[model samples]
Target: MIMKTEKRKSVEDYLCSFPEKQRDLLNQLRMLIKKTMPQMEEKLSWGAPTYVLEGRYCLQFAGNQKHLGFYTSPATIRQFQTDLKPYKTNEKNTLQLRWDQPLPEDLLIKMIQFRAEEVRRESLK
Candidate 1:
């Protein structure tokens, strides 16, 4: 018997779809997320770059006309509500990063770490 497999779209392919300026920011975010958790899998989902750990979604990235969006869980958002005040957040699980605002590296690392742990914990249940 013969088996067939399909190739999946890579994160790099997704990043290349954006314009130069937006691509740069998306690349930087992708690198940061990779650095935070080297073991996570990167894939394209919902037309954006998404990171997953043990079959659980850890983070996602999207670009808009005005800002770059980093998405996580609502529980993670609530955990870092104070630090997120500088950026605009909507009912969805996103933290908007405008071009003018510097990326909050420390907070982002914390958020990623927390989400990774959360995903692991939930998977164990």
Candidate 2:
């Protein structure tokens, strides 16, 4: 007997699965990550849109019921704890971006850049 495997969804498909507002927020985050690190490979990882560098997770984002979750290394979150004070964060390395609030573009860029550097450093070791 032959069995068929489930098809994995692309980032675009995942984004489209959301409501219009959530989709827009997810797209905006996706575009920002792409613009920040065009070299990083983008794909669905852990059921979210993930950006990879040197085969390591650079960053990931997902649309939640009330907020968009920006995930990265805990170190990155600790590094930006001061800057991230205005936003809500959890110990699990998630930075919550509420739909009602403006996207913190500059801060996101900085966090992604820092994550990219971390990936590079890990690749070296």
Candidate 3:
């Protein structure tokens, strides 16, 4: 019920939750997400940007006044821990990168690419 709507409208729900001024940063993030994980099915999981490959979730995104939230599987985080230092919120599995500043675009793209590939690879086995 609740979660079904969350999953179905993940990206749209998350983006529309934010104000218009923040759309620029969110759009950049969306583009990089697309560039990095081309083959994944993009959908909503808990009203966020959810990318799934072979039925496995690769990542999700959310926005607030302070920062953008990156909700992803811990396995994916551990796989690219070093590259994550700049954006880490240090909250176990979740990470938060700031909103006012420009994100480390290349690194994010890399992380997405790596994570998507990893999830798909594991699901294949």
Candidate 4:
């Protein structure tokens, strides 16, 4: 419900082109994001699906060479550093969420929720 009809269609088409396993993973992640933060807005930006909350870009995700990468603001990176310790992260505060392996669902939900709160705080300032 957070996403517009057109945007949601685009995301569905994009994920459908992948294999079943990949599709399953992407769809699950998409659902988690949408359900966890219904106040956020979803869009396809920069050739990837992005989520905006409280007027700022809160999260971005994309297909990767060997994994799916989820982009988070620097604040989330700093706050979740300990929780994200096991992931292959780049210098830019992006955490690589691998698709071939089972994602740490609980961790992902926490991360997304943290990001949602951060965006709300930023929008207020």
Candidate 5:
């Protein structure tokens, strides 16, 4: 017997699946990304909202129960470690943005810009 794989939902569907609070937070992040990097393509990747540039992954974010997961390249995380000190971060590329805290718009913009530049550079190579 042959089996079929389930299709993943679009980014909009993924966002809509979350609760109101999480949805609002995710939308804020999405808007910020769109504003900062209008050229990047938005898609659903790894069950989350991902921004891509030149067919390369720029950044991705997912809503969790207590925090939103912000993911980028490890190099970008290391570059902004000091600014991210207050937030919870993993050894890899994940940064946890707590729901109770305000979104660090400026810091997130810098991180997103860094990823965009990195993706652009990689695309040229």
Candidate 6:
């Protein structure tokens, strides 16, 4: 049997607020996270689309004029620092994916998976 999907707010509304080009990219990113962690809670947090698991924030993604921002915990950033070194990042644990370059889907998937496990560990502590 086919299961119907319920519509989510805030994140959808936020994606709609962007231009088509950026909107498409944001949509793809959102879907990827949802596919990877269907049980995670999603909402608008800190002016971006955030995912939380078991009361702990797992990840967040935002779109900018020139790039997309992927936000996660500092531990994740440090853990993936070598792989993420090619991208621009900040001390706040955000990785910037430029509009001019291709999206690193594999790296992102790894980061999301890592964050999900981290969130789980946090909730247990």
- For every model shown, what is its TM-score relative to the native structure? 0.87, 0.91, 0.79, 0.85, 0.90, 0.87
**Which window of ten consecutive residues has the lowest lDDT sum in model 3?**
1-10
lDDT of 3 by residue, 45-117 (tens): 6656777888887787777657777766677678778877766655355778887778788767767877777
Question: What are the per-residue Cα lDDT tens digits for candidate 6 across 1-125?
Answer: 11123443677778877777777888888998998889999988887799989888889998876789999988889989999989999867899998667678888889999989988988888
Candidate 2 TM-score, C-alpha based = 0.91
What's model 3's TM-score? 0.79
Q: Which candidate is the best by lDDT?
A: 5
Q: Considering lDDT, where higher is better, how would the candidates rank from best to worst?
A: 5, 2, 6, 1, 4, 3
lDDT of 2 by residue, 1-125 (tens): 11123454898778777777778878998999999999999989888788889888788897877789999989999999999998999867899999888799999999999989999999999
| Model 6 global lDDT (CA atoms, 0 to 1) | 0.84
lDDT of 2 at 62: 79
Worst 10 residues of 1 by lDDT: 1-10
Return the lDDT, model 5, position 61. Answer: 95
lDDT score for residue 74 of model 4: 80
Give the alpha-carbon lDDT of every model: 0.83, 0.86, 0.71, 0.78, 0.87, 0.84
lDDT value for model 4:
0.78
Error in Å for residue 107 of model 6: 0.7
Tell me the lDDT of model 3 at 9.
Answer: 48
Q: After superposing candidate 2 on the true structure, give the runs of residues whose Cα lies further than 4 Å from its correct spot.
A: 1-8
Model 6 steric clash pairs: none
Residue 23's lDDT in candidate 1: 78
Which parts of model 6 have CA positions greater than 4 angstroms off?
Answer: 1-9
